[model samples]
Target chain A: MTLLSRRHILAAIGAGVAAPSLVRAQSSETLKIGGMLPFSGPASIEGRQIVQGLQFAVAEWNEKGGVLGRKIELVLEDDESNSTKGVTAVRRLIEREKVPFIIGTYASAVAIAASKVAAEYKVPMLSGGSTGAGATDQNTAGDPWFFRSWPDSNAQGDDTAKAIVNKFKKTKVAIIHDNTNYGVTLAEQVTRVVTGVGGQIVSKDGYNAGEQDFSSMLTRLRGLKPDAVYIGGWAGDGANILRQAAEIGLKAQFVGSGSMLSDDFIKLAGSASEGFAVATMFEASTPNPIGKAFAERWRKSHDFDANTFSALGYDSTNIAIEALRRAGKPDGLEVQKMLKDGMKDFPLVQGPAGTTAAFNEKGGVIFPNFIAVIKDGKRRLDV
Target chain B: MDLFLQYVANGVVTGSTYVLVAVGLTLIFGILGVVNFAHGEFYMIGGYVGIVAITMLKLPVLAAIAVVLLAAALVGLVAEAILHKPLKSRDATNSIISSFGLAVALQNAALLVMGPQPQRLNLDVSKIPVLSSLPTDFGPVFLPQQRTLIPLTMVILIGVLYAVLKYTWTGRSLRAMAQHATVARLCGVRVQSVAVVTFMVGSALAGIAGMLMSSIFFVYPVVGNMIALKAFTVVILGGMGNVAGAAVAGLLLGITESLTSAYVANSMRDVVGFVFVILVLLFRPQGLFGKAAERS
Candidate 1:
């Protein structure tokens, strides 16, 4: 083997150093949008669906010659459904990837955590999956870069409590929520609304996520003799609760947030899910032309039918694209301003027949919530 | 009074599953002296096995249970031979770390195979003739036919285990090994074979528990995480390596959690176990049922 000279070694080192920057320069022609999602953790399944929606919207936009005359590119980072990891992922997107805007996050805690970093970097971060109200609560005057396309948990909870009180005419309500940020925030909203309407909350309790046995809790709720029970948790636990409640002969109207509006809930709860009402923003049976097209496209690609999270992901990506088009540049502050002021009566894949989506002053989405009930193993709109 | 009885019934049923898992863990620790952090993964595997046996193979409930047990035993044998046996002479921490790695690997394997969706093991009690004939509603306590199966299975399995441990030659050898491994081996106990048997039995117990609970809770990849934590708690509360203590502690912890959820805040139900464990550790380090370490 021939020994390398100092000049040859120096040339090799220089090439290695220049390689990454050269690649970056070439890729700079494409407008890069960051996606922070839980692609490999507990919420990975939901993250997969959201990514699909993001990719679908990006593909559609690219087909139409991309945004700002630049080919749109998506830079993805896995947050692992964790708060700390979410912050790290968002920082990488803003600092390393240098994307002007981001779309993501399934978990509320992750969304809330990552949005702080996005706000610090002055990058517009659009959340499509997280429903917790705390994410938008961080959009202050000093750092107003977070926007949520999906309706918050408070909206769903408010509508659910109204349905239980005014529609179902249930005075004594018991609330069982998972002890997570999303569940707790939603439960608090329901409690506030129910008590505000002269309704008595007999028993309000929280259970850990993945808890299967709700026997004692249901038995205790039975003793309270409440007219309705509001469940604020994931679909798995909610299904188990419904089944256990029926087994213990706890006869009360069961209501839940958008988390319950899934086939898993109806399938797992079986006959117990009959008449179980949930307040949701997105339904597969949405009558809107855009929603119908999205659902059809989703079904054509994926084996299963489109759900709320996917619709949220698709809508949020489209919202970001629309803002970018209106802003006429890939500037973060301009994109944020467009999202805040320009998106008035924006059409969404979610909401009612004639309902439109808009961003309120707090960066939260203003959309109509619908109450649906499980009827003969199918979720049908009740109100 | 009826409400109290109902809560108690609920506690007992929930406790039965805990006993099954914790007893297996205790037995493995007692005999092999190997802290199997992967014990919960066996339970998860059992649920998946049960689902496959029933859904894909179209087996009856009894046949599906047998399939789960056999599959779990095979997996236990492989795990013992490869993961445990090779590192047997090394530091105990080595085995523990290996088992922890095994747990992660097994969990991810299950996730890859089953996907992330939670699957229900639809064992219809109405279809079972004997179960259908039994009265479900007893005064104030309403125990569903499916739930009643849990305690019944727990009693039968524990009884079989107790009988085997008390009367059989293998049982005597196992007890001897638990008492003193070196002395037992010197007395021609065939330590290696006995260790394998102990691991298999323990894994089978955990697997069966998973199968039973899956019918009620539904089965997911990470389904065993919470139950395994509860089992470890039971193992500690009852005194590690003490089978009888595990049984008692499992039932006691279950009742305590149920009562706490009913009387106290439901949110504090899981916290009760850790708190009790801390109290036990501070007050009685030898555990409630565990005797003081005796010199041979």
Candidate 2:
């Protein structure tokens, strides 16, 4: 140690303290992205898995020296699967946190509600799980910053209708859906597609989510004697409806949306779940290089099996990062423009569903559709 | 006519479930003079307990039900100690507020532990003799073995509870406390003990309902929230503190729901149920079978 004057020592201390921040300030520091997740409600199971995938992606990116020399930071807000709460969460992310990007909302209604706020503030929002048709409709009065990682219900409904008519060879079908934006809209689309294909819809019904008693509904449907029953809802409600239908001895062949193709659905429906078919995006049994690696890493880290939601979440994060890279800066407008211009053909990783994860003009993902059935108490890809 | 019978049968089955949940709530309210708003959470807890018993422990159906009853009773006992006993007043509003908080806490605890996914009990009774042997007429009057079991079990349990309340020493004490808590305490009745028994019995009833329905409706954290509202409606329709009335009204409400769903639109089912409640309140505020307001 050399003795020095007070001014000399002060100058040396200032230099040491200022050097790191100067480098950080020049390199753009850390970029924060907001996440509005349902971490504490009925959809928490899916939300937790989704966040796991997002965190995994962020960690991997940081390990390779983060995008634009700045580590990505995620600011999470719990939407609780409620539309009002989801709006508040998005507002906080935009107004207070000032995050340029947001990904979230397991429920479609919540996503639609939050997107309004995102539109008002001019921030880009990518929904990881919401599949409601309203999430991306250009007709909606909003700034076109809303995009989704999964295909909308209209696409699924059209595919499901095709499967029911062409493959199952069913002409008379009854329909029931959960009374939510996702379920109701999907049912509407399915009805449209079925009628368009000349299939007669004999009966239409709706029930609240979390309702377990479908004895009366089944009894009424049983009287009609339709050739098949189409359920537009998530797995939990679908399983309940299927089990009750079995208990009531309603023998209509059952078909559900892609949301029903999960291990949980199989476990809940049990033997009643046998013969039920679903048209879904992701099938865990499907062999894909990217999906296998993601699953392996997920299982090793989380000590649990990853579902389709997790895979989509991982893919969505990658898409956002790519857009960030293409933008070449942290400005929200630049990033949104870049994504709108080229995200449709961007070469993203192959999803677990074994489809190239590409977006259409409406921010809807374009992927191959596969039909699955619960056979021998497992979700097996049928066609 | 066969379809009519089927609707009736369906109503009875649905009503039996309502009776199990409503009677317990009325009994607790009558004795404790505190509306246990967390009653639904107890029902939810019962479902979870039943799942654990049947799936994890691999217990038989009856044994699983027993475990659920015991566990839910214990939870109710602890809840009474922590939440109810501390309240300075027995006002309905006070109890409602405290129990509502308890309800939120319990639901959140369940979500944290169970991960918000619904789990099934996986108990099927397709081959039971008595249930299978039941006479059925085509599509309408058909009653599965498991569906028949709901009303049968409800009748048996209600009979037992009635006999116990009518004959047992503890039953007399509970009735006496319900009539006049201060007078009973002054007359040497152990108020604390009666309160404990009330919660236990009420919680056990909720547990039994959850266990029985777990096979059909499945088990989840929010499973009881909606059913609890319907049960409350039944309690009010049958007279706020009348157990026998809850049983009768529950069956009536269930039938109404079934008929409404069949003849009217499905969405009109709950609306009709509430309409019945409104009409009952307008005409007979004491409920269909309840006694007129009395002065001590």
Candidate 3:
């Protein structure tokens, strides 16, 4: 199911020597695919995942012969996770690299910035990690050139209520967040879900980012005493809460949004991370064939595998390739048209669908989330 | 009651950090007769150097702390000699202006080497036993290692500073210079050399404070802004150029900040800390521990 990669550095080095002719030939026949992601700074972890995912699919695609008759020549750039840098990376990828299509710039701020550039350039840009609605919809009818692979927070949360009822049967849960808009929105989603399911939110608490203390909040939480606490925050503050909970013996099962499935969270929490369950859009540790293959490949190359962000990138790359194949020409306008037509679950070997991937008008995968729990220092499927 | 205990615990820890920061700022003013505006960047340097020592060089935490101190001390020595000495000898304002420039340069240098995202030591406070001494649950107000260590360090540091200033020949020289630099030079005191050491010691303390802060606080590039500014307030509130004054002021500032953040919104903690300093300054323009005859 996976290729046994040999360390053919000599061959690859030899290929590097002959790269000029390949470049010359590549110029004539290859379709330039640009990629921009946060390769440095705070968001570098997610950036690396996106790069790996894009590389994996691109390798697999080339292995099966290039998209259409032209080889995909990917031009990668680092946005440093800044919106300003994202614009520079996108502009460089567009004007300098002359990429006909692009698959990146993951941060919402970055995605929003790069999409504007893509719209300006009239190049089809698909971002998997950027969940900001503005990435796709700000100028949808007027522009139509910009697109996103992942659904924004609104769509993801719309399904979260049904997910809570059908999946966890969670009745009474507490929602904790960092008081940021992102955190508040996510908590509101769970709150809506819990209430809609005739469940009660026993408590809700919010803390500021970079807060060193959480004792009072946890104490307040102990009194409210819900079945579980859903943390709607990023790795740093959320992990601190988790650590504090373990120390204080606040033993309501900890649950969180997809952010909990990230390696950043796991790295921060360490062994204390055990028994933490999370609703994730994707988990690389799944028992499926795709999961098994990704695990093997990721392990061979690096110590840590792709988290949710990596899966998002992998999904995005395959979507771009399919859209390219469907579009036939390397024309950005044609590909944008194809993307708007809605890809109804084209054979994503790694997706929830065996061969189906579709985004409703909202550009969200109706695919089920892989609920995971940290058991024995590794993620185990809860459902 | 639990929340109260936790807040108290947090206040103590928070107070300790304040003491360290104030001492750094106060020491410079005490010795050089100049406000070292770049003191916060020294704190920033301490964090970056500590991270590089621990993460990049794979040194022990103690080694990281020591390395951060030594590295920052060297930077201070260089700044005093090449930067401060030339400028100060020219006039007071030149050194002051140069120090601000130095701060900007060091911060950008740090930003160039290590990007702007926050860098935690990649080590948890709970992993270190001293920090987790208190039961974990006392809710979130309890000091995890990162929060607890700074206060403990402040105690040890304040003790060391006391010992150095009271007992050591070097501290005597620094004191002599602080009291009367030109007169001390006539009295066979190495005033210039003492000034250099004062800067080094002050910087070393700031660096140590920064390293401790990395664990407790969000160790970001801009952390210098928050801590350095607090140190300034602490120095002014304690008594400008007063070592003993700085210590008392630091503790008071910390408790005030912690209580304020706990009771008021966390964001208002800074505002309240400064408000106290302003109120004190309004009453006593010379500062809380104001001493006449100390000109630099």
Candidate 4:
């Protein structure tokens, strides 16, 4: 009878430990896609929406059999809506989890920070919701590894500014924006567009993201007496500003960026939300077939209506999966090549009817922004 | 002139809320000598309690306020026992670190349970028939019935607190303890009970501020963070333990922020508080209303 020695036993155990990993590498049973989102910080709500959309798309794909004959698995990391946290999360996802592709990040600052890490690792990353101009602009001058499914701040600002000046015909405008990358960049874009269109900007100001008090700012705006007030902030702060504006009797045609296109804004603002116009990509009232299908499916699962965040997340995932299918392997460079070469007239859930997302040379998509106004607490398409 | 008055009105409204939060902080710091970094959690707790009372329990506005007070006081008692009491004999930094940890834990707990959605406590005075018909517009200044309640409530609360501190035997004991804990203990003052009472009162005030402000501003987990910083600034600018100084400083800070936003720039509003604190620390380190530093 043959007996094993101590060295042999140790070697056998080591082999046993290394065998499973080798098998895993060979088989590649599931393709893991990393998602970095702010699940706990100030932008947690948006993160939840984006995750929901991503989950829905993944579930649908799995039902039909995932890409490359393998079931798709999502490994998520919470960025906490912070840039530093975002960098750490992305590094962990790329280095530890070894995910070839990454999707994320609702906050613009986080997206910008995380995308640089993805570029450093040569892993293609797609942003579902971040709209800051810097997110794409910084990448364009570099490796161009980051792709955005959502419209950048410049597109939304330009469209909204045009509507405010030409459609609403309000020449004197006041801009109040949150001091984040998203708000600040959008405000700049709006300023550029408004001035280019010969509209006058009377007052411009920025506030912190979670700032609740806008009484002084509103009063100052009232003194300036701008015909229209453009708010470039998220739903929560926007609602507070609107409520305070109404309380202090600062009456003007209130306009906002796409971030205000959520039910939370209307519910929080209550009657103050009436007649508030915003530039948006996805509205629940859209007649687009893909959007309608997504909305119907989303409503069946969630108690709330589908908004732009979810739509963008769904489109971003589909684009990533499509690129994966084209690549025929879970390889970062190949997938990125497929994305750059193949993504054209890509069907999207966001933007106007018949609008499709296509990446520019800068790896950015410019979807047409539709102006929607809150009439009786419902967002109705205005222009 | 009208614009200036409007700015003042805005500042006063903002200041009243700050006063409510700052007074409680000063009371706790003055009496207990604990920095109480988690003081803001009590405010956040009060806001959540308000949501439960008004929205879920369907209580009236007055009843909701009472509920918030009771809940906050209970929480304060728990915090005193678990967080502050054991660390009472330790160095101040230990307590500060522990309290900071408690703040993070409580914030995460709230986030886990409530799911980070901004909730509004519906205290719409416009819904009441009598108040609805009242003129909301005062010439060029528009004072909504709801906003008018903020300063009025602050005044009433501060007055009652003053009267209680001035007349009651419990107040004398608390004052003695604040003046000198060893002497007060020797003179038959129950330092432990007084400390508990101080926490309860301080936490209750902060909670009430949260409840009142939640009606105007939406209630969320992190809602207390910004206000707590302002309250700290108020505490420092007023002299750390001086209650009256906190009240006046709160108003001054609020007005300064308002005028800064109005005249200088809106982005500069928050910068005004830190700049004032720095200037005050440089010139009058003892604070505007504080006497010469007493060597504890």
TM-score winner among the candidates? 4
Tell me the deviation in Å of residue A319 in model 1.
0.9
Candidate 4 stretches with Cα past 4 Å from truth are: A1-28, A140-143, B126-140, B293-296
Clashes of each: 0, 1, 13, 0
Residue B236's lDDT in candidate 2:
84
Error of 3 at A364 (Å): 3.7
Predicted complexes: DockQ each = 0.40, 0.36, 0.20, 0.43
Per-residue lDDT over B120-216 for candidate 4, one digit per residue giving the tens place of the 0 to 100 score: 8887575555556767677776777777777778999999998888899898888888888999999999999998998899889999988878888
- Compose the digit string of candidate 1's lDDT tens values, residues A1-383: 01122123223323432343345446557788888776555565567567767877777787687788867777777776788878988888888878889997878888888887787777888885888777887778433577887567777788889889998999999999999877888888888999999898888999998888889998888888999999988777888999989877899999986767767668889999998998877767776677877788878867877777778888888999989899998888888888888887678887765545478777877766778878999877754
Candidate 1 stretches with Cα past 4 Å from truth are A1-31, A40-42, A69-71, A287-293, A296-304, A353-357, B127-129
Worst 10 residues of 4 chain A by lDDT: A1-10
| 1 against 4, candidate with superior DockQ | 4
Q: What tens-digit string does per-residue lDDT give for candidate 2 at A1-383?
A: 01122123223323432344345555576677777777655676667567766767776776676788877766677777888888988988888877877887778778888887887777778876777778788423323677776667777788888788888899899999877777788778878888888898998888777777788878889989999999987778898888889877899779997677667778778789998988766655556666667667777767656667777677777778878887898767776776666666654343343455355566676665567766788767754
> TM-scores for chain A, candidates in order?
0.85, 0.83, 0.81, 0.88
**CAPRI docking class of candidate 3:** incorrect
Give the lDDT of residue B80 in candidate 4: 83
Candidates in descending TM-score order: 4, 1, 2, 3
What is the CAPRI rating of model 4's predicted complex? Answer: acceptable
lDDT of 4 by residue, A37-62 (tens): 76766776677677777777777787
Candidate 3 lDDT at B205 equals: 86
Judging by TM-score, tell me the better candidate of 2 and 3. 2
Indicate whether candidate 1 or candidate 2 has the larger TM-score: 1
Q: Give per-residue CA lDDT, model 3, range A273-370, as digits (tens).
A: 88787665656655456655665766675577666776677777878788879988777777776776756646443435353455545344445555
